[model samples]
Target: MKINYPDGRIFNSQPSKSSLHTTNAKKKLIFGDRGMTLEEEINESNKYYRAHDIAVIYKKPTPIQIVKVDYPKRSKAVIREAYFRQASTTDYNGVYNGYYVDFEAKETKNKNTFPLKNFHQHQIDHLKMCQKQGGICFVIIKYVELKRYFVMPADEIFIHWDAQFDGAKSIQLKDIEKGSIEIKADYNPTLPYINAVQQLIESGKEKK
Candidate 1:
């Protein structure tokens, strides 16, 4: 099974640092803004979907490899160092209306181009595998500096990735304009993504 890394990188499951809610809190304090991290926005949106029974999506837990352990107390063990193992799949996965949903959330500051380096080869492979299984796979990309968001389909990403070495490496904003679903900012869910997913499903149905 695919596992997530503590730093939001997905990897294989291995014993590692005991989860500290305090660490998550610290991360929030440092990164939190009206415009939170793209991951955080997706998380909150998932929570909203759960509460409303719209979909059952979640951010997968991270996998950690604990190297050193200290039994400082009878009740707790402290982990000192760890290295993450390789992940076998994507970051988020779940069922939405009987369809498999798998995707990643990312952010970029550039207004004209979305860099290909933001995505990893392993992640692209994972998404391709998921798509072959008739799953809906996409990325929720946030142009943070422009305050714009787009749900770019995995296939579109793959096309560029496949030709990246040939010099068509970057996903231009104009390209995104043609294929991606532009998401409007919302009050409660912040980055409303379910709407984008719904649009994707609808568009797929139209094609069929």
Candidate 2:
């Protein structure tokens, strides 16, 4: 199978089983292959949101350039080599309550702080640009070790991001708690982040 990207790049969809095994092995060794990482949870939550007519958010697939392919049989083909063509804007984006919604989902094993290195300069700029265009932009951060999550506004994240040059490399857990909205994990939608988004929208109205 071949998948096409919006930029007109095409990639082979089939990956070798050996590659999958190796990737899963690495994940198991590092994160115990829990099969429920932050990305997966958010993806499931998006599916729920779409199903219930709540929102229409989706994870953006990374575009890749396929350089080499192997055809072992007449009916089978596999991708042998591939590389990223460029950096991605963010993890998720879509429409919610007539607002353009954009955000990135990130998780940290550190319990006390989230390292600023987890974010990229391009992502920060993208959020800033989106906010300027009247879009709701934020980041969903998960403290993996502590089993906690927060929906942090992009403005708050920018504050900490700018502080990096002043010798601040990470945001303290306490600061995150003070500046962000905590979200309770649930079974139905997994992360249920849309509720926090609703609160953010209402809070913005109150300020206005």
Full-model lDDT, candidate 2: 0.80
lDDT for residue 109 in candidate 1, whole number 0-100? 81
Top model number, TM-score: 1
For model 2, what is the alpha-carbon lDDT of residue 125? 94
The residue pairs that clash in candidate 2, if any, are none
* Stretches of model 2 off by over 4 angstroms after superposition: 1-35, 69-78
TM-score of each: 0.81, 0.80
What tens-digit string does per-residue lDDT give for candidate 2 at 37-67? 6775676577668878999998776667999
What Cα-based lDDT does every candidate model obtain? 0.75, 0.80
Residue pairs clashing in model 1 are: 4-62, 4-63, 12-86, 16-66
Backbone clashes per model, in order?
Answer: 4, 0
